[model samples]
Target: MLADMRDEVFDQDRACQALSHDRDRLVEAMDSGVADIDRLTFPDGPLTLLDLAVHVTMWDEINLGVVTLALRGRPHWSLDPRWETAEAGGALNVGGVRAGRGLTEELIRHRFHAVRQAHIDTIAEIPRSQWEQELPFAHSGSQPRTLGGLCHYVNTPEADPTRKLTYQHAAVHLGATSLSRAAPTGTG
Candidate 1:
């Protein structure tokens, strides 16, 4: 019991620190990326840099809800209607993320911070035992995932899920590859 208590604090601290750093990097990327938003586009889809930011916040929020529900052992995606729409459409669907609201740079940035705080706050409140409880997303594979797993999934990198939630995944990793891929090849 004592060991679990220590592990819980450690895990929550690790998650909080990682998320804070990720949020910083995300904001930095936004500062630079937004300037060229009009020129950037994903070849496989219709996502602009702004669209990507919305997508990041959009799914991150849903993941927050998932973690919240899982902690209670009632892991269902009874979250914002917008998230349901996003899930229905697919990962890259800008329309689903937008949900009809016009996304200004300011709003997206604000939303980014707000959602990150929501995720951080919610995860912080969970007891240690809950972190290990398996909670599948609306459409997950056989392998079970927990709150810690989700945090690791977003913070850590792997080949699949190509687009991660934020920080190392979205702002750093995806932006790293996509910046070059999205750039037009021609003499300026």
Candidate 2:
């Protein structure tokens, strides 16, 4: 299964494109209400919608950071800890889910949009050759995931991918059906 996932990661460009498209649909879906966001039970306990948003945002930012590093061959400047603290502090609005509080709907939308755009830019800038490079024993638990691995996870189905995918897949699966109406006929 890991090997298959590796093959999928090699198709990073496709994964990036898919992720960007899915993110757009997710943002649109979220426009309905905070309740639209999925919930998960964290080890700490049950997570609220706001908590789920923060969790998703964190994963997206981390993936974006990894992709940026892979493309640029260096790390970008990190945001100030204060900003993180502030964001965390506001996580109480949705019953301490660490999301849906302190932030207006528009602000949440813009933040997600910016993250998605950054991912697109990173994907566009990275060369295919770079993505194929092997970094054996370089990625473990603490280190960032390799570009190839990240890409694969995005495009391929997993027995149980990260929770992030559960939220994203819901949006994409729905959008694919809706958007099919706009596709050229005789293709499906």
Candidate 3:
């Protein structure tokens, strides 16, 4: 059992490391400060480079909360949109906005490290028993989802629409911002 648990947890650790490493490489690619990225835009509405940075932290916070609850063997939790909107406001209050408004490239990089570490700690602390258990996504899907599965998916270069979209999002922010020689070393 212990051996099996190690394998399960190790995948998650590797996935996390890859994500962090990618972000770290992004920092390297960003030769200029936040001012350089101020014009960062999404083809979609209302999303900027700052919004992407803040959303990453916000989702990290949300994922930690939901996964923690699930690991504790609690019922699936619901995230209030009102609560999320308010939280976004707070992110802005801190240094989540763009160059002159709130955030700097340095600070954004720092928050990514901090929030990603929090996720690493949270995942490490979850018991092995909860790993394969099903976890609810923020929205419903016909497909099933599980804690361990999510870890695996993010780490591995699996082909799926959702995964593709996620990588697309990451590319828009991290890829667009900079380029580095860092090849992803983990499942992702």
At residue 8, give the lDDT of candidate 1: 24
Top model number, TM-score:
1
Error of 2 at 93 (Å): 14
Decide which is better by lDDT, 2 or 3: 3
Higher-ranked by TM-score: 1 or 3: 1
lDDT score, candidate 2, position 33: 38
Whole-model lDDT per candidate: 0.52, 0.45, 0.47
Better of 1 and 2 by lDDT: 1
TM-score of each: 0.59, 0.55, 0.52
Per-residue lDDT, model 3, residue 60, is 60
What pairs collide in candidate 2? 8-152, 9-152, 50-99, 51-97, 91-98
Each prediction's total of clashing residue pairs, residues at least 3 apart in sequence or on different chains, is 0, 5, 3
Candidate 3: tens digits of C-alpha lDDT, residues 49-135? 445555556556556676666565553343344533545435432443333236675777677668767776777666666676677
Provide the clash count, candidate 1.
0
Tens digits of lDDT, candidate 1, 71-162:
66555443334534534536434454555247667888788889878877777777777776666453232223666765554443232233
What lDDT score goes with residue 74 in model 1?
Answer: 59
Stretches > 4 Å off in candidate 1: 1-10, 34-46, 78-92, 97-101, 133-145, 150-167, 176-188
